[model samples]
Target chain A: MIPAKFDYIKASSLGEALTLLQEHGDEAKILSGGHSLIPSMKLRLATPSVLIDIGGISEMNTITEEGDEIVIGANCTHHQIATSDLVREHVNILSQAALCIGDIQVRNRGTLGGSLAHADPASDYPATVLACEATIVAEGKDGKRTIGANDFFQALFLTALQDDEIITAIRFPKVSQGTYQKFFQSASRFAVVGVAAIKKGDGVQIGVTGVSGVPFRATAVENAYDGTSSAAKHAMDGVDDIISDHFADEEYRSHLARVYVKRALEAL
Target chain B: MNISITINGKLVTHDIEPRISLSHFLREHLDLTGTHIGCDTSGCGACTVTLDGQAVKSCTVLAVQADGSEVTTIEGMAQGDQMHPIQEAFREHHGLQCGFCTPGMVMTAADILKNNPNPTEEEIRHGLEGNFCRCTGYHNIVKSIQHAAEQMKA
Candidate 1:
């Protein structure tokens, strides 16, 4: 299926991308890997007048290590993340989550920055990123600022990013014993309920996806971690306003969330 | 918009609408009908192609986005009368029944072998999940990839 007609502009660098975004305002949509945006465009769910193509911007296509954090450019594809040694060393949970996203084809072309920016409720990155306590960097007319993973996702298919803002990179802090476990939906392979558990010293952080309007850190589960299955099932006891869809009712989703959280914590 | 791409080791340029997907550009414009479009939403990997040596769903990629990139489709796998080792293995193992998903299967299998030359049956099965086959029950498909992996090693 062909998407509706739109002017495509390739940004030569980060500077050009920022300028184009500022000029076009809300009429322009930043195109990274185009996995999410192109599909929505074809379905007529999104019809932006202009597409600021940032896929070829070499500046925003890297994964590097600086001190204790791993900095990944926004254009870093899931395939890149999955195979990257730096990612494996710093935050293996992100790579594990990246591997579980869709299939090999999707992983090759889907970008981490794009996924986080799109903020799909079922995406794999948010859970791991949030669990790692990552920070997302954005560039706009006002220069640069970092948004914590906790405040990044606002709702389903929504983020805290402004219309003119573009995600530059995501920073994941190195942690000990991190893992992700997901119960996948049959056809799409999207997470039915995915949980990421990260262990840093005596403290454990947990994030849950596909059960809420947005990906959220399961604070109740994290705080209630007593290292037992009995305590794990009650992780969702206070997680109200769970999303209900055709694939799963709210009750089932909540149930899956707790089960997956227990499994993730066990793996960690 | 005018964009140029390297398809099957050939450089081609076109002045077309920005909306045309890489899958559509390959099939309609370049007449490389071997790349099939099953589910245009990137679910079915029928339109799978190697963009810069990585397998990607072409339907979810704009042709304009492929500018200055190299794309290897099913047409590039074989050399004239000589079929690629993957194709030979598929034929020998009875990997395909309908043959509708063969191109994508071969393409994805090629990528898997590229990444991991010798993959287990579980790995091959996991690799083929993106490219769906309604026929053969996937037993032969797994065999085909395993066979191809051995052949490539030889």
Candidate 2:
């Protein structure tokens, strides 16, 4: 499936990418891993006239430690994160979630920033990032800023990222214990219902995806946590707009959400 | 866009449109038809190829993205007349029925073995989740990979 005709510019650096983005404005689309973007373009869902390939930007491809947080570059592939010892030690839920995304071939090329920026409701990272309270770092011609995971995902296939801004890194706080449980949708391997649970002292934070139009932190489940799986029942207490498709209807998706949430919490 | 790529140890350059996918480039431009395209979408791994040591679905990757990268398709597997151990295993174990998904399965198997030289049955099954064989010959495919792993290890 061929995508629409477009001019491809391989940016040598982050600044060049930003300049190209601003110059092209609405006509441009940032090509990171291109796993999501390229497919969308092939389907004619996205027909940007200019593609600013940011794969050459070396600065946005590293994983580092910054004080209390493990800063992961946006361009880091899912395979890289899944195998990173630092990520495994600090925030293992991110690693677990990364391992659950797509498949080996997909994980080898797909980027975390691309996935988060695409903001697919069934994507695995959103739940992990929300559970970890990760911070997404964005850069643009104006400057740089960070958006917490809670505020990053706005709607289905929508993010808080501006047109010209690029996600450079994601900062995840150090967590000792966490787990990700996902019921895959078979063909695409996207989450039918994915739940990420983080154990913090006496409390827990839950993040759910694939059950609604927007991936969200399950504050109700967290609030109802009594050190037992019984709290998983509240997984859909406030999560309306439940997605129903041929893969799963609303009732089954909700049941899977609750089941996966319980599994994640029990695993923690 | 002008792009250069190393395919099966041969560096080739082409000035093509930016919309051409790596799978299309390999099949159309280079005439390397070993990399089949079952589902134009990324769901099917029939277009699987190694881009700089990583197994990726070539259909989803733009040809321009592969500039200056080393790509290994199924056609690159054999050495002279002697087939690669994995390919030989497939032939010996009768791993393929229709042979449509063989290239992708072989390439993905190579990647799986490269990463884990001694993968168990469960690991091989897990690694092969991307490639689909409509012929339902997965049992032999798994066996072929196990035999190939042993052959490569020895």
Identify the leading candidate in terms of DockQ.
1
Output the number of the lDDT-best candidate: 2
Residue A33's lDDT within candidate 1 is 84
What is every candidate's C-alpha DockQ against the true complex, given to 2 decimals?
A: 0.87, 0.85
- Clash pairs detected, candidate 1: none
* lDDT (Cα, tens digit) per residue for candidate 2, span B6-88: 99999999998999999999999999999999887888899999999889999999999999999999989999899999999
Q: How much is A11 displaced in model 1, in angstroms?
A: 0.4
Q: Candidate 1 overall Cα lDDT vs. reference?
A: 0.89
Residue A142 miss distance in model 1 (angstroms): 0.2
TM-score of each: 0.98, 0.99
Docking class of 2: high
Please provide, for model 2 over A32-119, each residue's C-alpha lDDT reduced to its tens digit, 9 standing for 90 to 100.
9998999899999999999999987889999998889999999999999999999999999899999898889999999999999999
Local error of candidate 2 at residue A172 (angstroms): 0.6
Error of 1 at A226 (Å): 2.2
